[model samples]
Target chain A: MPRADARANRAALLASAAQRFAIDGADVALEKIARDAGVSIATLYRHFPHREALVAATYAREIEDLAEVPDDGSGSVALARWLLRFVEFARTKRALGDLLHAPGADHPPARGVLLDALDRILTRGRADGTLRDDRDPADVLALLAGLWTLPDDDTWPVRADRLAGFVLDGLTTTR
Target chain B: MPRADARANRAALLASAAQRFAIDGADVALEKIARDAGVSIATLYRHFPHREALVAATYAREIEDLAEVPDDGSGSVALARWLLRFVEFARTKRALGDLLHAPGADHPPARGVLLDALDRILTRGRADGTLRDDRDPADVLALLAGLWTLPDDDTWPVRADRLAGFVLDGLTTTR
Candidate 1:
């Protein structure tokens, strides 16, 4: 396969893996992931070599998504969007569970990445007078920890969104 | 012992159990609890036939504490006070762990009591225009679930307070 085709296939596989992992958990079959990515099982193994490698790569992709702060100039809006992403990240992380701790899974520092992302948004918001300066990013993160405790049922998404919204409202300046 | 003395001893035992359980967890020595209550082992046993009975009674006391909504007339202030108590309750609940689920423990319906307490407060707050009507009491309860997730360390009290404050801010009408 050409280099560009290989890159596309790798990206597709990662995306498929992330989606399946979030929905079906980390034990989801690699072959099903490859099929969803419109690739063969051989292609999946050629790229990832093993399940741990694929999970780690997908996790890295998630952290990268969180780190990429939009340059929208509105801190509140950026933070709001980021919070929704954070909720999704929390869900995926919960789904990933012990897989991230398994031997040979080389994922990045999630807490550090998340705190930095939150700090950047909070700093921007405070400077722009869009967010309250009373809260620390760590405090916000701690408050958002409620996301992890929410029951993993059908109403999880709605409950997670509401919890995030409450955090956001608390962080925003009283207009 | 007189009826009033017996009642006092029982109340003291429950209070002592709540404190010790919150600090040292459910397995704290029964003798220690008896000592803390300034009572003999026989008195403690007379009031609570077994550890499960003590745990159940302690749990019921917590629910009653939560159910008592102060008529302070300011829903925000009342809710704020209640949130702090709720945090303490969460801590004690965490410490209780499986004790509450022990086969013979006859604790009241915790979730129902909590939701009803919150509903009463939210209704009062909405009536007095002290709280935002957009969020449901259940949503507030869900958001406050962060208290349960805080690490049970030295900083837990501080972190729990901050998280509760954030939730309070979210529920209060913007001034």
Candidate 2:
């Protein structure tokens, strides 16, 4: 297969996987994914062996598409702004964010990148006195996770932002 | 049955329901609850004819037990302490709390008393300038629900308290 064709095939597979996972959750079948992607079962199996692998790959693609920290001294403000974007990402993707974070699941290759990005933001906030220094980045992530736990509705973003503001204030220390 | 025997049966059933819900989530069988309570299946049916009735009863009982909020006049300090206690109730009950908050799930009869208690605390805090006057008490309950969203582990209470403090700070307008 040509390089372009292989890239297109992977892209189609991921797009369909994201759709299926969104509609039917992470238990979607590989064959169904291939059917939805307009690819053969052999093509699907060639691209990914199992459900966990497919979920990890699809989520990694989604994470990579998220906005990264701007290379400026805007500090914690930038971190808070980026977190609002992250909350939107969690809302639109629904349970996929939790699926990615679900423990004992197969390891994703990009987990380190995700955690490091979070660590960088919190570390910057602490240094700049915008966020409290008492908690770890993982706790920050867990607190932000409140978005995914919300009810699925049109008002999700509104409520999620309030929760985000609450978390941001929690991370910011007095004096 | 005598009134004394009937009340004893009710207490036993509620205790067993709480245990089963804490262990097996909201989907526990009524018959199992009856057996656990050492009562006849007919007795369980007589007490709670449906799943929602059983859940409402269990949640009401828990809320009643947790309504011992101190009337101490420390403003948001009092509110914060009460929220910490609420977090403990939610943490120990785990997913059962989620079931209560699920869409279309009816509030237990005692929910009014709990809400009133919380509203009084928030109202007092606002009067003392210790908490923000803008956010609704309903919103506060929804935000503090971040506790139930955390992982069920020994560290959960400590993590929950930290998150609660974050929310409390957000609710505070003073400094």
Candidate 3:
């Protein structure tokens, strides 16, 4: 493992990249991302040789963060809460879809990471019987995929909140 | 008023356009649509001066079809029934969003039409107390927006079906 300062630099660069990707497109300049993260351009490339590598790593960390959303005692409730955070993930990752799903690529680099997190949460819910067994993690992910289609306009935040609530209500408890 | 044969030609052209637009894109050739509809190119142009006009009109007709989905007698059940139909509407309309949301356009031409249908269904549900009053037609549409985001893979149909069921369950009578 790298030393603490190196790790911190990596984290900061990734955070900067995610923020810029959300605000602008994924093609926001590497120099700007490095400056925003308080690191030099050389440091960023030292950590991640290619921009795609940085994007993939940042996305992996996001999935890790999603996986780490603490259980709120209620299995279904925990999944519901995690989904509220997932809206940002869904929308932000969409900006990177074209990049991650580059020509000839088999799957999005982020997809498996995201799906695995979903699987863990869903598996816990099923184990506890707090969620509808009939619902599959794959299906849940597919349902959440709708988030990518929303118009990013003034009403998007409100719409996203409503959409998240809809998913939570629909996915948990017996039908 | 258009004569009987002229009216038939108009309906055929619109039907052909909608079919072609769904299978292909909104930019499908006018000649091809006319040929598919068994009308001449002149008839297609006469009916719709511009491709945008045909897209808007076909989209309007789709909304009318949605509005005409008969209530299954139960207010909530009626809305549930209509949402299954709404998927077809949502997916088919995805191809037309660009055409319908041309420069300076405030909203998709079909939005008000579909939302009106949703509003009527929801209002009835509220009156009957079978649906949650807090959920508005706009919110429901936002939730359903996920419908258009699904991948066009073999699994799409299954995912779409699950998503529709999720929406119905989430919006209906309280737990």
Second chain only: TM-score per model?
0.62, 0.83, 0.70
Q: Write the per-residue lDDT of candidate 3 for residues A1-175, one digit (tens) a residue.
A: 8899999999999899888887776678999999999999999999999887888887776667776757556668778778878877666575555443232225555665666777778878888888777777656665655455566676666767777777777767755
Span of ten consecutive residues with least summed lDDT in model 3 chain B: B96-105
Sorted into a CAPRI-style docking class, model 3 comes out as incorrect
* lDDT at position B150, candidate 1: 51
Return the candidate ranking by lDDT, descending. Answer: 1, 3, 2
| lDDT score of residue B16 within candidate 2 | 94
Best by TM-score: 2
Tens-digit lDDT string for candidate 2 (B6-125): 889989999998899888876677889999999999998888887767777777766776666677777788887887778777776764554434433245555456767778888888
Measured with C-alpha atoms, the lDDT of residue A75 in candidate 1 is 82
Per-residue lDDT tens digits for candidate 3, residues B1-175, read 8799999999999888879987876668889999999999998889889777788888775667776746556669889789878776666576654443222226555666666878888888888998888877766665565555456666666777788888888778855
Ten residues in sequence with the least summed lDDT for candidate 1 chain B: B99-108
Q: Candidate 1 or 2, higher DockQ? A: 2
Could you give candidate 1's per-residue lDDT for residues A1-175 as a string of tens digits? 5699999999999889889987787678989999999999999999988886787788886677788898887789888999998888787676443342221223335555666888899999999999988787767766665565555667778978988887887788856
Q: Give lDDT per model, in order.
A: 0.76, 0.71, 0.73
> Which DockQ values do the candidates obtain, in the order shown?
0.18, 0.20, 0.20
Writing each residue's lDDT as its tens digit, candidate 1 over B129-162 gives 9998877765776566555545556787887788
Give the C-alpha interface root-mean-square deviation per candidate: 8.5, 4.0, 5.5
Q: Please state the error at residue B81 of candidate 2 in Å.
A: 2.1
Best by DockQ: 2
C-alpha lDDT of candidate 3 relative to the true structure: 0.73
Q: Residue-pair clashes per candidate, as listed?
A: 0, 1, 1
